[model samples]
Target: MKRQIVLFFALAMFSACNKSTKSNATQQPTLADYRVGEKWVWKYKGVTTQGEIRSEGEDTREIVSVDGELGMTIGTDTIPVADMVKPDESETPKYDWPLEVGKKWKFENSWTSQDGTKGTQSQDVEVLSFQEETVEAGTFMAYKIQYKGTISNSRGYSADTDEVWWYAPEVKNFIKLTQTQEDFFYEEELIEYSKPQ
Candidate 1:
């Protein structure tokens, strides 16, 4: 259960979300863009090609105050808005800023699971389009970004992964993500979002 919880948060961190369609939107958000009362909710599920359900549930994040600093909740952690707004620190970051259609880049990451098995992910990422996308939560202009890559672990487990993600700038987050890796498949989508107007 703990491992699943961690993976859930990791997925959310790696895949960002939001709902307004500003056709020409660019520029990564800053800490100032967050508000304490803002909240985001998503529904996610993971399964195998064999029809086995690996996981299913909902995830939520909300901005709040912590020690006078703005904090965002994820699983059991409350991360500072300042930290959340910074560009990802990975050498081949998951996201390249000022995202635009036709933009392409490399994305990579290395991780050690709780069992101490090391793994690496290497992928080619492309922003395919900027257009309207609709999910259960609502409709917004979003970027259709795709990733293709391979993931391997020290234990000899490896799989090719292909993913498509839709990021909505008005909501400042990803509205949907679908991933396929070998026999495993995973999807997550935004279901609710609210903030003080």
Candidate 2:
């Protein structure tokens, strides 16, 4: 009777271990739960190698539902509208520009600072590539996504750039945006956020 009892306990322990292992094995990180309808704000700060410090105070971003269309906003402005994606219409693009590989979105306006600096600023975002990988950020699990493209400013100059985006599951936000252009680098962090009201 003691032997039978020991055998039963051993089988129970084995079953419990198997159940726990399967539970862990079936759990996987999924991006589907994250929605594009929410907007994110990135506050940028950079330090030059020459010891010069540059900073953009703070930026705001929002996601807008335009005429039943879905789109993103950056810094108190809307894409294709702040840039006027479609001119000669209702003051804004008639349709929301799709974000995808090989798709091109252009902003033909110049960028000027309040401090009297002027530059012909335009961003032609072509989704060159995108892929997801697993990364560890402290105690959080992060998905490292790389976005490669070119951004051209004034002087008819263009720079190939890549942005490393770390999406943390625990925070439900993009933790970092690392941009590199022609040996120059900048990084932005999500300091604050709010749901759309």
Candidate 3:
């Protein structure tokens, strides 16, 4: 009887810990998850099937205090972290909340690029699996999300595109991304991440 009781208690403790871990990955991140001075840097390169290197560079983003508001650098702009994590109002969003493996959804967006080229995107997004993915920064438990679909533009051009993103909930960001569109291949991997102690 004593042995059985001890085993039962051990199982209960394990079950509780499992639930706590699973919940950590499912929920969307909020501004509360970020802190000023946290930084992330990634190295990216894009190439074509014909062996032409289109773009290559490293991108860095840091959380900073902007007039008392928490903002993050995105390219040349600093946007409120609050806005970045706000409840995505899009009918078809880049990320579906409460992420879970095997979950699927459609994502669509229309935008004008920096050069004023207007384009539209439509993709079927799926959370393929959750596993440990290693990058230059380090290994972390992450979700493998896939986006497959087509992109078309006002210039009457269209192409099929597929992308996979490894999002690490612990980092509150994607650790790596690979995108394939027609003859072009692009990928970015996190090289460094830091947070103020």
Candidate 4:
């Protein structure tokens, strides 16, 4: 009777261990779990090419799908494809593709004026590479990403710039962004973010 009881107890312990292992295995991280529909309020701080320092701009964007389709608004202006200023046949937004490692995307962004006129300005970005890292807060996991890309904003003007982006995820959106372009470096943080009821 004693031997039989010991065997039964050992079997119960083994069953419990197996169940715990399976639960952990099913919790593996996936790209889709964290990189979709992230809204961010971004501010810009950098020097202009004309040697003037400016420190104000707000940017918001939503990745509508995992296939790289995005809706973005910068400073109350939406990017239009119909009227491209200084139409460059080769400028795109970096990360225009899905937010997966080893993936690439480009965006052709143009701006229009409030008066129903097209601004002679647009930006093209190309994503070269992407990487993710972890940061520390009080009791939360912070993810930071880096995007290397090239940009050209020429609208009958000689504004040529190349930049790299460093972004870190906030609670519900992008709270911080850094841009290093040519001879300019700028960083911005979220001042306000809200969802309409």
Candidate number with greatest lDDT? 1
User: Which residue segments of model 2 deviate by more than 4 Å?
Assistant: 1-39, 65-71, 79-141, 146-162, 168-173
Q: What is candidate 2's lDDT per residue for 1-197, written digit by digit as tens?
A: 11221122221111110111222221111223223455455566555556555544454555566675544464354442222222223222111122233434443334443444444423333434323433222333444445455555443656675655554434444555676666566666666555543
lDDT of 3: 0.72
Candidate 2 TM-score to native: 0.40
lDDT tens string, model 1, 1-197? 32342354344443353322365546677777788898989898888899889888998888899989998887788877776666776668877766778989998877776677888888899999989999999998888999899888887888898988888888888888888889888888999989878
lDDT of 4: 0.34
User: Would you estimate the TM-scores of all the predictions?
Assistant: 0.87, 0.40, 0.87, 0.38
Which residue pairs show backbone clashes in model 3? none
What C-alpha lDDT values do all the predictions have? 0.78, 0.40, 0.72, 0.34
lDDT of 4 at 163: 36
- Model 1's lDDT to the true fold? 0.78
